[model samples]
Target: MKMDYEQNAKIFKALSDSSRLKIIDILSCGEKCACDILEYFDFTQPTLSHHMKVLSDCGLVEVRKEGLWNYYSLDINNCNKLTLFMMNLVTETKDCICKNKSNCTCK
Candidate 1:
């Protein structure tokens, strides 16, 4: 599949926040209710919601609503794709963006 630079950029931007990175780490263990996640930090519910929304929007997180609480977990497929993307990005693959550049010094 062709890479969507904008989408990847958004995903990276969402991950740029330390809180969101920690949130990902928390969810890595398993899906957890919002309250359980909040226990790790001193933020308010609304702030957590905002962070979750950012994560969710980037396709890095998946959420489910049970009654009034939101449960969150990592989107494993997308996370794997992101990892592959980073790997490909740093390697000199045939599809590398610099393949056509004469100045590319990648060996």
Candidate 2:
């Protein structure tokens, strides 16, 4: 599959923050209510909301509403795609070419 750099960059950027990373880890176990996720952090509700928005915007996490509560969980499909893309980026290569044409002895 073709990788969308813009989308991937958004995902990477969303995960750049430590707080966001922790949120992802929390959701890894299973779906969690917003309150449940907030218990693990010292930040305010609004801050948590912001973090969730960023995660959701990047398609890294999903959200659902039941009554007055909001639940969050990791988007497994997107996460798997991100992982595969990263793996391919590191492992797949056509060839290595020397920059110096005068001394191009690479094989």
Candidate 3:
């Protein structure tokens, strides 16, 4: 599998901010409009928009426009892909061969 450094980097960079993480957590519960998210903090609309932009650019979240409102939601497909990638990284059998294996076949 080809590692997408750029994509992963974007995810990490976006998540580096606490506010962005909180935003993601909130969105995970359900889709929310920009104004609903803004209610959680004292930040002005522009600041929240910046964070939302970063999240959207990283593919961590997605937005849909309904009339005049922009609703954001967590991108579950991307999140699942990321989760599987991390699981594979830590669970690959090559690294745990004979250390704890009762049957070692790798020569």
Candidate 4:
């Protein structure tokens, strides 16, 4: 699939904030209610909600309402896109070591 640079940028920008990054890390384990997420930080409920809003708006996280509580989980497809993008950045060398004997700098 073609990469959406703007969408990826939004996801990264949402993660730029330490609080939001923390939220993502917490949710990475599994879906979590807003209250459970709040317990990990000292921020106010509204503040935590704002962070979640940014994450949801960026498409990096998914939000669902389970009765009185709001639960969140990472958007796996978008997460994979971001992961693959970073992987591509690290694997810039195109040729395999087997293809070149002397100039193969890959380790």
Candidate 3 residue-wise lDDT at 91: 71
Residue pair clashes in candidate 2? none
lDDT tens readout by residue for model 4, 1-107: 34466877788888889999888899889999999999999989999989999989988889999899999999998788899866665464454333367765566
Q: List per-prediction Cα lDDT, in the order shown.
A: 0.92, 0.88, 0.84, 0.84
Using lDDT as the measure, the top candidate is 1
Off by over 4 Å in 1: 101-107
* Residue-level lDDT tens digits of model 1 in 1-107: 45678889999999999999999999999999999999999989999999999999999999999999899999999999898888877777888787568998655
Question: After best superposition, candidate 4 residue 53: deviation in angstroms?
Answer: 1.0
- Which ten-residue region of model 3 has the weakest summed lDDT? 92-101
lDDT of the structure predicted as candidate 3: 0.84
Clashes of 4: 0
Candidate numbers sorted by lDDT from highest down: 1, 2, 3, 4
